[model samples]
Target chain A: MLRDITLGQYYQADSVIHKLDPRVKLGTTIIFIISLFVFQGAWGYAVAALFLALVIKLSKVPFQFMVKGMKAIVFLLLITVIFNLFLTPGEPLVTVWKLTITKEGLRMAVFLSIRLGFLIIGSSVMTLTTTPNQLTDGLEKMLKPLNKIKVPVHEIAMMMSIALRFIPILMEETDKIMKAQLARCADFESGNLIKKAKSLVPLLVPLFISAFRRANDLAMAMEARCYRGGDNRTKMKPLHYEKRDYIAYAIVACYVILGIAAGKLMPLLVSGIIQLV
Target chain B: MPIILDKVSHVYGQDTAMAVTALKNVSLVIPDGQFIGLIGHTGSGKSTLVQHLNGLMKATSGSIYFNGEDIDAEGFDKKMLRSKVGLVFQYPEHQLFETDVFADVCFGPKNLGLSKKEVELRAYEALKLVGLEDAYFYQSPFDLSGGQKRRVAIAGVLAMKPEVLVLDEPTAGLDPKGRDEILDQISRLKKETGMTVILVSHSMDDVAKYVERIIVMNKGSVMYDDAPREVFRHYQELEQIGLAAPQVTYIMKDLQDHGYDVSDEATTIEKAKEEIKSWFARLSAVGKGR
Candidate 1:
């Protein structure tokens, strides 16, 4: 059941997108997100969507898996739509039972939802293709220049990689604790809200204990292996940007230019109801 | 009542990109009152199979029956099923949560919605079954030694008065003495309460010494299921699957191959010694007749 959580999960695949430098992928994802928000008209949105679809396809990740990743943000998307649809003040396009639905409100809701959806999927594409270790290595290297300014870039990346690596281990541990409690006839699924929360005590206590134990053990193990931070560390797999990374960046640049051009050229087609009103 | 699994198959993350077949089409019947041992390497689906016996996992296809009733059928109270088939997971002591040993053990019975008096009664009785002293009941479980913590965890399950107890590697991290102590307590519990016990272990000696029947699993399939002696007879097959017969069985096989007249099928040290003694007696008699 815990395996179903696809948020920030990395999928292993051998594709050009997967082989690109992680720093390049990370940078392009940020740029793509910015372009998603900048593009306003249908043509601009279409170009941005096409670019995202192209990147996802190139990554060789299944479309369904990306949709699964989107499952977590469905609530956020719904909230955005609901808030915009009901609260935004504009010229009413449809009125019924003292409820007014405006063209601008509906437009804003759809545009915002679509933009948020693209933002999530676009960034997830990078994570799905790159391993956590690679992502951290890239981040550390990308942020190396900031070290001159006394920023703890390496420490941050190290923490991120460690966190990512332990996520699955911690999840498995939680499942085992829950099963053990269940074996003792602890009813976790049924019961009123308070009663259900009470059932979690057995599971939570052990999980916290085990997590602390693991953290201590890991720290000691790292120290034993001479893992002193940042000063004299050499990576086994160094991050290197290849020719393909440059090409990928070029494509992203072209996408931005096209997005800007489309946004300026297209006539704002606000769902036919706006002209009728 | 016997536990029967019929053509059960389990697939993790079904219909997803990360899908994995953890258990293939498998079927087995565990007779009531029998001490059954489940042996498998890591990821052989042994853990997954045991989880199904108590309804912790729903088989992707097929059914599990307890007392001839379909446990997988809708509306079957899974809590009752879980209470009946007690499972003690590996490193179970890690699940101990209550402040005091008594409260931790009583947690199970209390969750059963029993009266407070009944819960306390069963809690004390269960602790006694695991050989924990009454004086230790009020002390914090965290204060206990590793072995004692493990026993307290087992007692917590025993408080539910399960008909069948399933333990997954009960002695995994314990020292040799602690391992023997825990296993002896479990054996005694079986004898005194007449509860059916299923022990899951990777150690051949543990299974050979304590269980009557052994079920060997490899790669999500049941490779062998029979008496310990019968399973050991296929020592070569067991070795091929990254498993070994009990140490005594290996020594017996070696002694037999060296012309010592010892039976290769002896699974335990006592049985091997008996066979060797009987062979010596027959040899002396033959020499006298000659």
Candidate 2:
């Protein structure tokens, strides 16, 4: 039952977006998130939405799959929306018992929720399109300048790739341990909060032991192969930008510039649309 | 009075592009107190089928009944079903978690909500049944040898006193001697308690020697379900499906092919020896008559 995790999972699809260098995807994802915060008016958000839709469509990853990742953040979204809806002080639009519903509060809540949502989808676009190895390679290359100040960029990247590789393995291990414990009549459900926590001891202890054993074995295997902290390592599939990557950069740069310009020229644009209509 | 699976089919990752049909429309009736061997090639759905018996997994389509009650039905008391049908998973030794061997064995009975005294009593009995001496009872389970840890893990399930014990590759990583020891203990336990035992194994000889019935699964379907002799008679078909009959089955078949009066269906060495011995007596009697 624990196999529903979608974050950091790659969706295989043959598309221009997937073919672009991982550095382009990484840089654009950050730019997109920053643009979400920079956009203030409906016109700016509209431009951002159009850009995001174009990219998602181009990537060929299913829309429903992207939306599925939003489920994991619903509770956080709700708390942010509720707190903003009730606590923000402004000109009151409605009153419900002790809670004050102000115009600005409603606006803030809607905009904040939208921002949080856009944040997840924006980041997922990069993770869903790029494989984990390419991601680490891009990161290591991007952070190479930091190596001049002894940041150990290669080691950090190596660790990240290893961690990403083990996620599914450990998840499968946990599933097996849970089933084994369950067969012995161990109840993980139908208990009070503390009791439930206590019930996890049987599941957790075995999992921890297995994890350690696996880690030890992995370390020995790596040592046997003469791995020494990513030192003097050559890339098997090194990261390099193609023509599409430069075009992607231009698109993202134009998006940010347009988003900011749309906020400034919002009134003119709305009046022009109205006159046209 | 049998555990029944009615046209049960299971599909992993159902309704998705990656979906795989793990079990076909397979139906089975496992009677009480019967020792059955479940044999199949790897990924042949042997593990999935056994997991269904204890409700560890639900069928994607179809139902399983335990003693005339629908197990997957709402409010079916699955916990009780699990206690009744104990499943010792592959590498069960990896599931031990308590500080000591005895406490680990007691984990199952305690989860059954039995009294403290009863939990310890059953744990003691189970450990004894598995032939673990008292000296190792207080030692940490992690410190034991591979075979000892496996026996302790088996006793942990046995402590729950399941009516039907299902073991999935219990002797997978053990040496030949250890494998024999554990299987012998399980056979003795079956004889002493008359409980239904289902052994899932890759070793043809082990199943042919110990189990009363053999169930051959291939590509998520049962190809044969009969007594050992009856099933081994179709050894040619079994081998074609990436499985083999016991070595003795091959020997008996070779003897018959060389013009000897011996049954080719003997599935075990002892039975083959008897068949050959009687064949010799018949040959000597015919020689005297001539």
Candidate 3:
């Protein structure tokens, strides 16, 4: 059952998006997020949606997987839609009791929901296409300039990579511990909220103890391997940007510009009864 | 009741890139009231196969029958099946959590929604079965020694009154004395309760000492399943598959190679000594006759 966790799970595939430099993917994801906020109209949403679909197709990741990825944030998406639908006031499309659902409110709900959905899917596309090691390599390279500002960028990336590497191992350990508890008849499934939380004591105590033990062992092993911090450390596989990376960056820049222009030209959905006349 | 697995196969993370076939087309019937030993190397699908007995894992394809009834059938309580087929996982002492040993041992019967009186009664009985003292019952389980903690964990499962007990590496990582104690307790439990026991272990000596039948798994299939004596007869084949016969069997085979006329089926130390003594007696008789 723990295998259902999809977050940070990279699907290895031979596709153009998967082949792109991880730095380019990281930068493009950031640009895409900025563009999402800039794009306000249906046309802009269409462009962003089309771009995401193109990326998904290039990555060769299944549509059902993207839908599965979206499942984690479905509750948040629903909340955003409901909040925008009832809370935003304008020319009323429908009214019930004290709540007024306006045309603008409806538009806002759909736009915001789609925007948030696209934002999550687009960022996930980057992670799905890149391995954790490559992602950390890219992050360290991108943050190299921050070294001058004393940000310890390399150390942060190293920690992130280590954490990512241990996630599956830790998950397996947790699954084992849970099964052991279950064998002893620890009922985690039934009972009220308080009772359920109480049941977690058996699971959590062992998990925490084991996690700490693992951390200590990992630290000792790292020290034994002479893993002293980022000073004068040479990487076996250094990050090198290719021509394809530049082209990918240029495409993301153009998409962002088009999104900003679309936002400017699109008719603004005004609030209150100003649009009724 | 016999535990029957019919063409059972288990694929971990099916349909994903990380998918692996842990077990394939494995069929076996563990008859009731038998002490069955499951021997295999790491990742040999021994754990995966045993987990299906009590419904800890559902078969990817095929079926598992507990006492002639489909365990995966609708309305069949897998949890209750779990209580009936108690699994004591490796290093089970790590699962202890209650402030006191009594509360921890009672956890199983409590989950079964038994009355407080019944829970306490079963807990005390289980403690006694594992040879824990009455004073140790109210003390914290974590304060006990490693072997004692393991016994407490076992008692926690035994409190459920399981008919079939499945243990994974019950003696792993224990000192020799501790190991013998645990094995003796299990043997006593079987004799006293008449419960069927399935033990998963890597030690051929342990299996030979206790189990009536041995099942050897390699890769994902059962390579050999027979009486302990019969299985150890194919010593070379077992070694080729990365398993070794019990030390006594190896010694007996060495004696036979040296023309001592010892049987290859001598798997226990007592039997090997007897065989060697008989061979020496015959040798002395021949020398005297000459």
Using lDDT, give the best candidate's number.
2
> What tens-digit string does per-residue lDDT give for candidate 1 at A199-259?
7888899989998999999999999998888987888988776899889999999999989
Per-prediction count of colliding residue pairs? Answer: 0, 0, 0
Q: Encode model 3's per-residue lDDT on B42-155: one tens digit a residue.
A: 899999988888888889999999888999999998778889899999999888878899999998899888999999999999999999988788898878999999999999
What tens-digit string does per-residue lDDT give for candidate 1 at B1-290? 78999999999988865688988888999888999999988888999999999998999998999988999788898889989999999999999999999999998999898999999999999999999998899999999999999999999999999999999999999999999999999999999999899999988988788889999999888989999999999989888888899898888878878888767878878888898889999999999999
How well does model 2 score by local distance difference test?
Answer: 0.92
Off by over 4 Å in 2: A271-277, B255-261, B284-290
Query: Comparing candidate 2 with candidate 3, which one achieves the higher DockQ?
Result: 2
When summed lDDT is taken over every stretch of 10 residues in candidate 1 chain B, the lowest stretch is B260-269
Best by DockQ: 1
TM-score of 3: 0.88
Recovered fraction of real interface contacts per model: 0.94, 0.86, 0.65
Worst 10 residues of 2 chain B by lDDT: B13-22
In candidate 3, stretches whose alpha carbon ends up further than 4 angstroms from where it belongs are: A94-101, A147-150, A261-277, B15-18, B132-139, B175-177, B257-260
